[model samples]
Target: MQVLRPQTSGNVDRVLDCHGNKVVLISRRRVFSLTAGCATFLAAPYLSLRQSRASDAIELPEVRGGGKIRIGLLWSLTGHLSVIEKPSRDVALYWIDEVNKSGGVGGYQIEPVIMDAKSDLKTYRSAIMTLMRDEHVLATFGGYLSVSRRAVMPLVTENRGVFYYPTCYEGRECWQHIVCTGPLPNQHSLDLIPYMVRNYGPSAYFVGSNYIWARESSRNAIEWLTQAGGQLLGEKYVPLGQDNFDVICKDIKNKRPDWIFSTVVSDSDIFFRKEYARQGLSSDRVPIASLTTSELEVKKLGVSYGEGHILSAPYFQSLGGATNAQFVDRFLGSRFGESGVTHFNMEETYLAFLYFKKSVERVLQENGHVPLTPENVRAFSGGLHLSNEESPEGEVHLDPDNLNSWLKPKIGRFNGLGQIELLWQSSEKVSPKPYLLYPERGVCLSDGLHLPNGTIVKAAS
Candidate 1:
């Protein structure tokens, strides 16, 4: 058997000088010699060895045989808006699991690539780019905070990809690549403001988080209020995660408006409610009507703080209907145990994903296995109509131009025990008006109190 030998360079001068020309057999078969001349070449095996070790360290999902559909779920999983964003994330996963259980859209199992924005605009921008470029996700459904949505909208439009945003927002922006599943200002705030003023009173104070959604929504409210014979008491803006409401509370006390109309979002709402209670102000003394606080936030506020508070939204957990009941049952049973359904964003997320699935299915059925391109999704979405009993505002219709749903808004009063009961609902669908619908009118104001005598008046007036 011929043994493989290592190649080595012969240095006769060193050997002659050191060994004095002694006869010595050079084996030329050492490990160091074997690796010398081909050091770079030797690196290949070592590099591959390191890579193999790394491969063993990390476990990755195997790409399933046959067709695979990639969908991205980008949401604010951390930072200020995580309370709302986390539920959205969970609901997105729920929809993905549900779709896979039902044989998926167009016969391919969905590969969900979930990314966390961490409530940072830069992270949101980066996440969307990665989802589009690296993951090659066909479509994405996420974003609870309007600021984050606004950050990613330009990128999605430029890339010509589909981004379905599922939070209620100020409706001044519309894009070709974006589908907004949440109620717009017109669909929620515009109608709600007028109704509250008409039924309650016209003296209103506008309070909100210092963001595009709050600023724009508050502006819309001001317009509607002014139009409806309501007087504006004062306006204040707070940072989203702000803890200090002492100044704002003192201001509210001094103003003593019949009602405080607020667009405060996320944990800021909780702080406002707690501060309101701390100031010994009850809904009866000076009612606080908000556009953003929902069943989810109310739960977080607990019974004492949230009770008697009023909020306007398109849906609530207590909404009575077979569809809503089923949704509530499933959601609560799986997540919160037999009674877990609460957050408005959770329901909105469920609706968004279901709507997308319905549209995608329709397109596949009509177009015959045409892969889900953005254009195809848009076309399919144009003809989409979704109605369920769980929807507090009844049926929802999508607008072709804006790709936004026309849904009614419902008003609810928190009964202090974390239970929200519906008080009012739009009799008909409210269309999406991205621009200011009632810029001159502003928002309606009231005492925020529902009196037994059924008498309501504008506080400022």
Candidate 2:
């Protein structure tokens, strides 16, 4: 019902709701590259029916191997979502390349038939359908935002597709088809907020994008703050792709809450950090805490803009184990090159890809062959016991009862070099409870949200 207006300035285009939330859109050049180090090409193999059927259908380079395993990837590389999605794409390619070099899941080369949804919900919905109905992918790994995942859930469920969604989100669903490899509310909001209430103060402000992830996360934030005996100062939802945070930042400055919690994603996350700096707010004054601001966004904003901020997630580039150090060096060399930075979301997706790879192996080992079918893929994933050592994160195992993984939780502070400095870590791996039942002071009673651990009371939402 709302018509989007073209932007008069800047490269990214966006549609704004009357209340100031962004709707993402992309241009039509139609070229895609799997990784930044690779060559760009028209992704003909993953094209829509119209594009692939046209007389001038593009030809792709031939693979030298037999029985290549096709997996679908849906990410936004050219739209506003690209800010967050590009790194995930690069990591996916690099990780897959490594897997192939090491024999690749029962000797089948992993070929990701990549599709750029370009931040359009319709494109995401149709793309998942296309991958299933047309490409017949064995399994799929992508969808960074909650909205994108929500778009494809029904299709994935109805058609029996195995979708690995790797992002910290509002924990409100328990879809059987999706294996969430990121932290839920108990792992993040409940853990981080109580820490804030004890260390920072009781009063806090809430800021986020006007979407399901933000809305739901903020609602969970309210419940946790109240349970922890903290008071709400204010709450605001800004346009997702909005370039200016002057209005929201000014409100927070006036309120002077002990801390500001944010769920702003993609470009808006970076914008708000810079604006907060410009507003002269210091960590000692009113700290900014976020579930969405990760090493990727911190790298983009730089330490000048991103420093002193706090992030709560399952992994950070600075977690510094022998495994983490090796992964960081190798991944940085292959993709980032000059910028030695990565984030929780990128690592989470990388872990998701590894889970899929492990599942393929499990299916093959048990059934004698890996079938390129959704039922087979789901069964394999449903029974997998993924090792955390293979991942930079420590001791990860997927829950068969729920599709999410038991992951370690950590809080980090960004430094001058665009890296997360580790602050605190959970005592052990936390269970994945997608439907959060909150927790009690560091121990999960009902479910730390397919999460998350701590003695958090179940969320009111």
Candidate 3:
């Protein structure tokens, strides 16, 4: 394994020699260049799309006379990621239908331009171009994987388009064109690692899919684990569709770590969880704690295989309260029916549209009958808050600084019925520390995170 050493370059901290891969960690205040691969791809399609479709004074579709505000919904409807992405697409469609029922946003009915990227990078590239060029969508929402997000991000930025990303991702990015409604590592790992260490033990084994989201999330998990005085047993990353974990489970059983930190997502997660149980292991002994497993996966894996494993997410379908109750009822009554159990991704997907609606209304209210464009909506969207009435998660705040949401962090385990039974929850919403925002001295061992402007906010215990 190549040891990566952090070196200061200007104001950025660059990690060198991580298996010959350069990792650039950007600060909260500054913007960093996209990856070389992303830059190269952008040089061709990104420019051509911007030049051909974008203009200095972009024409706004008139709300009157059958004019519709075309909103793009790009997701994997038929692929490995379809299990997760399709639910989000359904939520987006549900939100669109709900908005239109209420007379739409700012006197315009949303015309959805939906595309299935088929979980392929090349498909994502072409599909996003279709949304931006041919369909001329006002804003696009999709991307479950970090690679998919990175694939079309340059295009989104170059065209000055808006993208409401709903997946909880590995942070270190602050994009002006993206509104991230999902939690970051600080939201998931910070609260989850310590809780696991305290209850389970001070030793862990990391297993994740071989992808940017899993690798980077695991990297942060290790940092948080070390800070809490926990020991790492071993760490492994497997290919995306890797179904066999016989060797990995054998190693885990031999090492006998207190807990397994899993960043494995999608269909692979189901297989891994079942394989863990099939190895004569139980979560009561060595639980597979995950950031990605939700009601969606739990249902597929069944209660026998999924129960006792822990999950950390902002929202769960089984949560009690009138707000969540109403949200659940509405979704269950929808075309998706009971089978479409709401998860973290779907909740955030719905919240994205809520924010979009509020952002558009605010723009129209302040500017007074002005034409709605992606730029204006983007300008008004930062730092938007939704109350418990509007949000099922009680309260949500989109951080103006980083374009990420301040989310309520909750940890839970699957019950007998394949639903999340809440274990621990923050007293209030935890602020987003997408860039880590650790103190200059060292990693903060407590729940408190040091912000860029010198404010240290304490997370709920």
Identify the candidate with maximal TM-score. 3
Q: State the lDDT of candidate 3 residue by residue for 212-323, as single tens digits.
A: 7888898898888998999999999887767899999999999999999999988889888888888898988899899989988988778788788899999988887898
- Which model is ahead, 1 or 3, in terms of lDDT? 3
Model 1: per-residue Cα lDDT over 1-461, one tens digit each: 01133233451111221213111112111122111222332223223223223222322112233577777777765566777777777776656655677887667777666676666655666677667765667788888766667656666655567788877888654356677777877777766777767766778878888777778788788888888888998999987677789998998899888788888877778888889899888888777787678777766767777777787888787888788777766766553232244666777777777777777778777877755676567567864678765353358877765577778778888885677888888888777766556333332211222223555322111
Question: Could you tell me the TM-score of candidate 2?
Answer: 0.80
Model 1 accuracy (lDDT, Cα): 0.67
Model 1 misplaced regions, further than 4 Å: 1-66, 335-339, 389-393, 436-461
Angstrom error at residue 3, model 2: 36
Q: What overall lDDT goes with each candidate model?
A: 0.67, 0.71, 0.77
Model 1 TM-score, all chains together: 0.78
State the weakest 10-residue window (summed lDDT) of model 1. Answer: 21-30
Error of 1 at 144 (Å): 1.9
The C-alpha stretches of model 3 lying farther than 4 A from their native spots are: 1-66, 437-461
